[model samples]
Target: MRITGHHPLWRIAAAVLGGYAFTWGFIALGMAGAFALGMSFHDAEHLTAIIGFLIYLVLFLWAFAARSLARVWAVTAGGALVMAGAASLIQHQLT
Candidate 1:
């Protein structure tokens, strides 16, 4: 049983590392948006943290089940950037 073809390693990496990055971005955006929308700091933090766990699970599974590694990487990495950037903008506006 030599499961050594295609890009299993890449998929695993994306599932773990990429998923983590994407989840982090999601948390950042959620925190900022929630706070800006009048949520308490601790409330927003706890809320986003809870949602982020579910998001990470979904993304991890999707990364493995998805057919296109490129798309997975793109979405995870690109989405992270976009979300983080949005969070940054929100923070700037709030400040």
Candidate 2:
């Protein structure tokens, strides 16, 4: 679980790629939730996009700093799946 002994490539991939997936899911869920709450589409998207950038930065840094690569991957990947699924459900409801 220690990040140091494992290949740095894994850490970098977790940081960049996993962070992107998590951030994308966050944006999608945030936008959908906000829109469901009656926010304008453009406003919801803009707000969520801004928040997603900050979330991605945090996730990217955490990927390197965390002691467990498995935990990092699980959180990012699992969160993405759950959030994206919620977003899809919200979108279906909206439609």
Candidate 3:
């Protein structure tokens, strides 16, 4: 038998995976952005930590509310990839 609508397990899975991606995305982008802006390591770390927390909450809720599991995963993964790419480009320029 196949399940219909939004499965609870899938929602939970999306939340877990998306949460990690969100964190790593924030870490990469935040660090890179901070560095590009010339902020010191200590200051940038604190800034990113705070920003990550707020973003995670929003993403967590969004994951559950989204219509489909695939949509959530795609958006989450896409966002993370974009942020990571931006970080890489910024870092490259810095070096």
Candidate 4:
């Protein structure tokens, strides 16, 4: 499907906003989960939350800048995978 220039502009904007919303929502949920688990945000475990939020933000921006749906999906998914992998490796080494 072809997205017109103007249409893609709106889609990009929506992607950015939607991505931001999703990131914040996840952060809130993470914080809530921590609280429920009796863990404070001051704990080292909360580092994962920060990494996840940054990954989501980057993926959203990647998707927004994409020219096509396929491209957007590919870029976003790839970014997520890379981010997740890096986070896991770093966390593993830190522990």
Candidate 5:
């Protein structure tokens, strides 16, 4: 079935929810990585990592609200790259 011209509000809601789910999933994966790396949750660095995750989450939500899938993808991908870069920077800074 061909779906056409869905309400922009519905599109926005779907996009936001999608972005939230994606962000949460990524955060969970990062937490798992931290555990693997023997990083304790009580560490100040852990808090910084969570703050970075929140920044990415906000970026994703902003992109979703813009209602352009191409822009959303670009922002999401860019955020992911930035997150990875940030991780490397954090490692260098901490070590």
Candidate 6:
């Protein structure tokens, strides 16, 4: 999975997109988990921000380190979707 056959800019773009996906996805998932645990809104937000950075760094590394740009997107998008769905479900349950 050599990163090839495209402009370097495209590769950089993919990495940037992947980084954003992972960063937000992790934060959303963290907040979702906190909500599922019945945490207050303020506490959930603070906790998500506190833990999200470290998680983002690891996920950002994972995104750029992928052998294929497409794989980076697939994993990031899939993870985000799953987390979003879970968050929605948890919120629904609470309401």
Could you say which candidate leads in lDDT? 1
> What is model 5's C-alpha RMSD?
7.1
| lDDT tens digits by residue: candidate 5, 1-95 | 23358655544654565455445445544654564477785563475467657865676567545656656655555555655665555556546
lDDT of 4 at 74: 49
Off by over 4 Å in 4: 44-49, 61-95
Segments of candidate 5 deviating more than 4 angstroms: 1-5, 42-49, 64-67, 70-95
How many collisions per candidate? 0, 0, 0, 0, 0, 0
Q: Which stretches of candidate 1 lie over 4 Å from their true place?
A: 1-6
If scored against the real structure, what TM-score would every candidate get?
0.93, 0.94, 0.83, 0.51, 0.45, 0.74
How much is the lDDT of residue 38 in candidate 2?
97
Q: Taking the tens digit of each residue's C-alpha lDDT, what string does model 1 give over 1-89? A: 23467579989999999999999999999999999999999999999999999999999999988878889999999999999999999
When superposed on Cα atoms, how far off is each prediction in RMSD? 2.5, 1.7, 2.7, 7.9, 7.1, 2.4
Query: Model 4, 4-79: lDDT tens per residue?
Result: 7687766675467555555554454455455555676565247546765785777667666666766565444454
Clashing pairs for predicted structure model 1, backbone only: none
Q: Which run of 10 residues does model 2 get worst, by summed lDDT?
A: 1-10
Candidate 6 C-alpha lDDT tens digits along 1-95: 54456745655665566556666776776777787788887898888887777766666676566667677677767777777777777667777
* True lDDT of residue 8, candidate 4: 71
TM-score-wise, the better of 4 and 5 is 4
Residue pairs with colliding backbones in model 4 are: none
lDDT of 3 by residue, 2-85 (tens): 466657777777787877786788788898899789899888988898888888888889887777778888878888888888
lDDT of every predicted structure (CA atoms): 0.95, 0.94, 0.83, 0.57, 0.56, 0.70
Model 4 lDDT, full chain set:
0.57
Poorly placed runs, candidate 3 (over 4 Å): 1-6
TM-score of structure candidate 1: 0.93
lDDT score at residue 51, model 4, on the 0-100 scale: 62
Worst 10 residues of 6 by lDDT: 1-10
